[model samples]
Target: MKKYLHTGILIVILLLSGFLLWRHSVQTRVSHEVVRVADVGAIAWVPFQVGLEKGFFADEGLSISIVSVQTGDESLKALLSNSVDISLAGIIPYSFVALDHPEIQVLALNTFAKDNQIIARKDSGVSRPEDLIGKKIGYSKTTASDIGVEFFLKNHGITKGQVTLIPMKPFAMPVALATGEIDAYSSWEPNIINGKKLLDTRAILFNDVLSTYTWHGSLMANKTYIESHHSSVLAFLRAWKKSAQFTKDNPTEAIAIASAYTKIPAEALKQIWSRYDFVANPSPEEVVSILRTDLLWANLHRANPLATIPDPVTLLANINESKI
Candidate 1:
C-alpha cells in the first residue's frame, strides 16, 4: 500500500512539473521579442535613443538592441550580413546597395534636408567657392561630404584639379582645419558644429544650393523581416514617430538626450536640430527625386563605375505610409 502511495505521489509531482514547464513556455512567448538594429551613431538618430530610454519600444512589445557603427555604410553592411534587422543610414550609401539587395527596404525617412556643408577657416580667405582654388580641402571620400565639395566646385566653375583634396576621416577634419592641415573641410554636423566652436571657421557653402539635393536620413530593413514581422515594424515606427514628436515638443529634454547619447554639446545640437525635418514618413515622389539626383551625382563623379542607376520608382517596396 505504501509503495502504491509513493507511486501516486511521484505521478502527481511529475504532472505538476509538466504544467509549470508549459506555463513558463507560454510566458516566454508572451514576452517582448528582441529586434537588433545597426545604428550609425549619428545625432540624427536621437529620436531612436529617446524611444529606447522612454519605454516606447517596450510599449510596442519589442526590445531593440542597437549596434553602434561608425558610418552608414558600416550600418548597411551589418544589416546585409544578418547581424541586425535594421539599419539607420544616409540616402547615398543606402542607394548604392538598394538595387542589389532586393530584400532591403527603406522603412522610413526621419529627415529630408540639407545637413552637409563646406566649412572654411575664417583666415583661409576661401569665402567663396572660387577662393578654394589651390587651397587644401579635406573631405571623407565617397560620402555626402565629398559629394558636396564636388558639387560646390562645379557650380562655381572650379575644377577638381584646381584644389588639393585631402582625404581624412570626418572626426579629424576640425583639428586639421584648426592646425592649418587643411584650409577647408566638407563635412556634416555635429563635427562641423564642434569644429567651428574649436576654431575660427565659418560655413562657406551648404548643400541646399542644389534645389534637388536632399540629405535623407533613413531607417531600412529586410523585406523578409518586414513580411514576417509586420506588426513589429509598425510598432517600431510608431515608437520612433512619438519620440520624434517629443523632440519637437520638449526641446530641452530632447537636446539633453541627444547630448548624453552622442556626447555632443547641447548648445551645438540645439543650433543644428532646426536644420533637420524629423518626419516619420517621406513621400515616394520625394524619395524618387532624391535618388534621381543621387544617381546623377554618382554617375557624374564615376564613383561606382559598376553600378548602373535603376528606375527610382523600383528602388523601394510599396511602403504603406499608414504604418509609419
Candidate 2:
C-alpha cells in the first residue's frame, strides 16, 4: 500500500510537469502580421521574408505578417490604429511624425540601394541637370521620392520653376518618359531598366546621392507596441538582423528572394541589389537631413497649409536607451 501510494504521487508530479510544459509551449507561440507599402517594393524588403522563411523569427519566438501598404502614410496610419506591427517604408513617415507619436521609429534599414534615379531619353537635348530648365520632369505627389527628387534638383541648381514636375509612379516613369509626354522622370528600377529600353531613353544623371542621403527602407514600430511587447520587438529585430546578414551572405538565394518578392527578374535584382548597401543600422543624420529637406519642400510647395513639425528630432524616438 505504501509503495503504491508513493508511485501514484510520483506519477502525479510527472504529469503536472508535463502538463505545465505543454501549457507553456502553447502560450509561447507568437504570430504577428506586418504590413509594408506596395511601392516599398524591392530586394530590400527581403529581411522580413528572410525572417519568415529561415526560421529566424521562430528562433526569436515571433511570427510576422508582412502585407502591402497603399503608401507610407497608410503604413503609419495602420501603425497608429494598431493594424500592423511594423512598416517598411521610405523616410515619408517623417511627414506625419510629431509630438503625438514619438514611438514611431525607424528600427532598421530594410535596404540601402538607390533603386531610384532620374531617367531620360538620349535625345531631345536634355543632358545636364541645368538642361531640365523649362522642361517637364516627373515626380510623385507628397512622397519621400518626390521630396528627394526635388532636393536633388535644387542641389544641382535645377529648381521646379525651371523643371516642370509631373506626378508619376516609378514604374510608369518609363512610359511617361518614353512617350515624350514628359521630358524626364525620377524613378528606380525595374523602371530604370525599362525606361532605358525605350529606344534611347537613359539616365541623364543618376542621383547616387539618393543612397548617400542615408535614406532607409525602415522597420517602423510604435511605442505602445514596443513597451507591451519588448521581447517581441527584440526577437523581431534579431531575426531581422539575421535576415539582413543572410541577405549579405547568400546573394544568389537573396536575389531569388528579392526577385520573388519584388517580381523583378533575378538579373535585374542582381544588378540593383548589388549597388545598395544592405545594413541594418539607422543613421540619425540621414533621417534628419531627409526631414529638413522635406520640410523645406513642404514649405516651398506649401504642401501643408496648417501642418508644422516643431521638432524633427522627435521623429527619431529617443528612449532612455536603445532597446535592441
Candidate 3:
C-alpha cells in the first residue's frame, strides 16, 4: 500500500509540472501576425516611422513591414490592389475613392494640420499673392496640394485661370523651381524646404495661405482585412498610440526617426514639427465633415467624378474609430 501511494504522488507531481510548463509556453508565445504597411515618406508619417524604429509593434506581438511611396495617392493604390494590408492616405485621395471602393476604410487619423505652402522664386516677380497671376505654378494634381493651391488663390482673389497651373510631381517641384521650369510651386514639406535651399535668398514661401484648410493623414485598410484581423488591427492602433506619446515626450528622437526615414534633414523636420498634431483617433464628425468638403472639391477637379456626392451619413461608415 505504501509503495502504491508513493507512485501515485509522484505521478500527480509530474502531471502538475507538465501542465504548468504548457501554460507558460502558451502565455509567452509570440504572435506571427505580419502587417504590411504602405506609407508616403514624409514628415507627416513620423508616428509610424517612430513606432517602427522603436519596436512598439513588436511589443504588441505584431510584425510590421513598411513600403515607401512618393505620394499618399500611390499608397492608397497599393492598399486597393491588395499589395499592402494598410496604407497612410491623405483625405483628398480617400475622398476620391471612398464611394467607388467600398472595401477601403479609415482606421484612424494620424495627423491633422495645415502643412502645405506655396514656394516661389523671388526673382520671378512674385512678391505677393497677387503676383502669382500669369506665373507658371507647379502643383501635384489630385492631392491636397491641388485643392490647397486653389483655396489659396481664391482667398487672394486670384482665379485658377489667372495663373498658369503646371502639373508636376512633388519630388520634381524643387528642381523645376530651381531650373526655372516653373516660377513657383505649391507643395508640402521636404520639397518646400528643398526648393528653399536651391533658391537660397531667391526663395519666397507663403506659409499662411493654407491655414484655413486642414490636411488629414489617416491610416486606412480594406474592410475585409479589418474584419478578419480585428485583433491585429487593434494591436496596430495601440502601437500607434504608444508612438504618438513617444513623439510628444521625445520630440528630438522622433524628429531623428522622421529624418532617417524621409531622408529629409533633421533641421528641416524640426522647423515644421510643431505644425502637426499627432493623434491616433481623430473625431469621426470632423472626418466626415472634411470628407464631404473634399468630395465637392474632387467633383469639380477629377476627370471622372462621382455621379452624386456621398451623404455625411454614408461617409461616416468609412471611418472606424476603434479605441486602443
Candidate 4:
C-alpha cells in the first residue's frame, strides 16, 4: 500500500508541473495586433518611421504595415475604402470628407509646420510676391498646397484674375517650372527643395505668406475601427508619444531614419527638421480653430456650391482625445 501511494503522488506532481509549464508558455507569448497604415511618404511622418525602426510599435505588440501614397487625399481615400486601418494625412484632406463621412476621426496631430513655399523662376520675372501677378502658378488643387497658393496671392494683393492658376500634381510642379510649363508653383518640401535644385540660380522661393498658416499632419481612423479596436488605438498613440519624444531628443538619428524612409537626402531633411513640431497630441481647441478656418476656405473655393458646409463643431466632435 505504501509503494502504491508513493507512485500515485509522484504522478500527480508530474501532471501539475506540465500544466504549469504550459500556462507559463502561453502567458509569455505575445500575439501581435496587425495594423495597416496609409501614409504619404513625407518628412512630416518621421516619427511614425522612427517608431517602426526603433521597435516602439513592437513594444506595444503592434505589427505595422505601411501603404505608401502620393498625397494626403489618397491616404484618406485608402482609409475610406477600408484598404487601410489607419491613415496619416493632412487636416485639409480630413476636412474635405468630414461632412460626408462623420465616422472618420482624427486620432492625433503628429506634425504642425509652416513648410509650404511658392517656388518661382527668376527668369520669368517673379523676383517678388507682386511679380507673380501675371505668371502661371502651378499648384495641386483640392490639397493644402492649393490653400497655400490662394493665401499667398491674397497676402500679396494679387487677384485670381490677375494671375492664371494652373492645376498640376505636386510632384510635377518642380519639373514644370524648370521646363517653363509654368512660371511658378506652390508646394511643400521636398518638391520645394527639388524646385530650387532644378532652377539653381533661377529659382526663388516665397515663404512669408505660407508662414502665416500652420499645416497639420494627422493620424485618422474610422469610428468602427476606433470602437472595435480601442486598446489598439491607445497603444498606437502611446507609441507615437514615445516616438515624438525620441525624435526631439535625438535629431540626427531621427533625420537618418526619415531620410531612409522617404529617400530624401539626409542633409535636406536636417535643414527642414527644425521647422516640424512632432507633437503626438495637440489641444482640441487649437485643432478646431484651424479646421474652422480651413473649412471656411473650402466652402468658398473647393466644396460644391449646393453642398451645405458642415459646422466645424461637428468635425471637432470627431477628434478622439480619449486615446490621447
Query: What's the TM-score of each model vs. the native?
Result: 0.80, 0.75, 0.88, 0.86
| lDDT head-to-head 1 vs 2, winner | 1
lDDT of model 2, residue 278: 75
CA lDDT scores, all candidates in order: 0.76, 0.63, 0.81, 0.81
- Residue 11 of model 4, lDDT score: 100
After superposition, the stretches of candidate 1 with alpha carbons farther than 4 Å from their true spots are: 1-30, 123-125, 200-214, 299-308, 318-320
lDDT of 3 by residue, 204-289 (tens): 98887442345788888888888888888988989998998898899999988888877778888888888888864556687677
Q: Select the stronger candidate by TM-score from 1 and 2.
A: 1
Clashing pairs in 4: none
Q: For model 4, what is the alpha-carbon lDDT of residue 150? A: 78
Residue 212 of model 3, lDDT score: 34
lDDT of 4 by residue, 1-324 (tens): 999999999999999999999997665436788999997877778899999999999888789988988778888899999999999988887777675776787777679867877889999987788888878999877677888887888887888999999988878888899999999987777778888888999998886644334578888899889889988888888899899899999999998898888667899887778778987455678777877776666666654642566666655424355555
Per-residue CA lDDT of candidate 2, range 151-264, in tens? 678678766777778877666676778778888776544556666666452545455663223344666777666677666666677777788888889888877877777666
- Per-candidate count of clashing residue pairs (backbone under 3 Å): 0, 4, 0, 0
Clashing pairs in 2: 33-65, 34-65, 36-69, 117-187
